[model samples]
Target: MTDPLGQQRPIDIKAQLQACRSKEDTFKTLVMLSKTQPRLTAEEKTEDNKIKGCESAVWLIIEEKDGLRHFKADSDAKLMRGVLVAILSLVKGKSLADIQQMDLKAELAELNLSSYLTSSRTNGVLAILDKITSH
Candidate 1:
């Protein structure tokens, strides 16, 4: 993935979120970034894609091809969509073992993201990570 300046490097969501000046700015940036991979269509947001433990409805789909996982996710709430984008960024194209090795909750803390979310929403973050890793 390329940064906004078009530098060639892996996408680091922690660094991206850390660059934001405030919660409001972080959320706005998240929404803007999410446009890179927008919400799903009605047909794709089926029950098979629905996620549990999210306060707002979220759907995630993973497709494995040529040994890499490609993810598609969507959420009903804007904030949750942001969360999904962040989490998905971390796991996109990773192998199953790589996903298993990740500590996403700790990474979220490193990004100062937990400060912006309530306990339930934080759990939702965990749930999303869990779904991805477990896949």
Candidate 2:
């Protein structure tokens, strides 16, 4: 990704999440980020894009550019949108190999965010990762 200076840089997603002083702050930050994510069009919201395990109707759209994946995700549920953004933050603009190497569960655990999620939501998150890696 490019900075405001137009210089190449890696977005430290983990560090951004870690900067949140509390869970509430983290959640708010995520929600804000979610609003910034590109919305998936109706044509892109087919059953194929919908995550099967999610309680919420979450849709993920991925495009490859120069070997890096760009993700655009959305959900019917508001909190789920925030969760989607958090997950997307990790993998966005990363190569498939980088995303495949990620330990998403461990990262969430380290961030103390996993404990706040319901089992179904966790499953949904894993499902998203599974879809990404399978691509």
Candidate 3:
């Protein structure tokens, strides 16, 4: 997918995240992609351990095994769960510097999520961000 600015781009983090609009859309895409990729187990979904801060009871687990970062996450809210999956897809295997360098605010604007998110839902998204950056 190309951006509105008319640029053909590589598979960078920003472009990948800009592909979705609402959190639900993000989730749906992630779920569909995961079908062809790999399914995350319950045990693997515990990274960064910020599950307690999530409004919808989300669990995220990330690990740096070998040279790649791995993530597995789940949430009671289907949409939020999908959002987490989308986030994992972008940052899961990246280094800390790469994850930190991502323009999360710009990506969120591209996704057009601010108008669609509740305060709690926004908080939940922040929790996910914290998890990614913390690792």
Candidate 4:
């Protein structure tokens, strides 16, 4: 699906992520995806946009246009940025109903990265998912 800004969506992100055979490969993919995540402007990094309950400072901006949601996010931590990109790949440009219906924890489990995450990191990821789905 095209994003609100009309950029082509990442190709089969689930497939790409699931293709990784090792944690190193997964981390590489996440880093690659992180490179594509849009930077939140200094002005846009307001407290209102910052995600609470995360160890790292994360800012998410969700814009709705033509009945679709567009997500832009950033984080002070690189791994968090990668995680945000992965999460955004799933929900960006989708309708609110579609996003709200997602089983995000299941999706992450499918990616097989759950073992790599600390409890705090998992909670942070959930915080990001909550921010997206709740919007």
RMSD of each: 3.0, 3.2, 6.5, 2.4
Tell me each candidate's TM-score. 0.85, 0.80, 0.64, 0.88
lDDT per residue, candidate 4, 11-129, as tens digits? 56677778999888888877876777778899999999998888889999999999999888999987778778777877877899998898878877776576557888877888888
What is candidate 2's lDDT per residue for 1-135, written digit by digit as tens? 545744223345455667888878778766765575567889989998899998889998889999999877889877778677667666778899988898866766655465457889888888998888779
In model 2, where do residues sit more than 4 Å from their true spots? 1-13, 19-23
Candidate 3's C-alpha runs over 4 A off are 1-50
Candidate order by decreasing TM-score:
4, 1, 2, 3
| Each model's lDDT | 0.75, 0.74, 0.61, 0.80
Q: Which residue pairs clash in candidate 2?
A: none
| Positional deviation of residue 111's Cα in model 1 after best superposition, in angstroms | 2.0
Q: Note the clash tally of each candidate.
A: 0, 0, 6, 0
Predicted structure 2, TM vs. truth: 0.80
- Displacement of the residue 22 alpha carbon in candidate 1, Å: 1.8
Candidate 2, residue 87: CA error in Å? Answer: 1.1
Candidate 1 Cα deviation (angstroms), residue 108: 1.9
Clashing pairs in 3: 27-82, 46-60, 46-61, 47-60, 47-61, 47-62
In model 2, how many backbone clashes occur? 0
Per-residue accuracy of model 3 over 8-116 as CA lDDT, tens digit each = 2225434555676766765555454434334446665554454655678777767787766767666656656545545565665678888799976556656544554
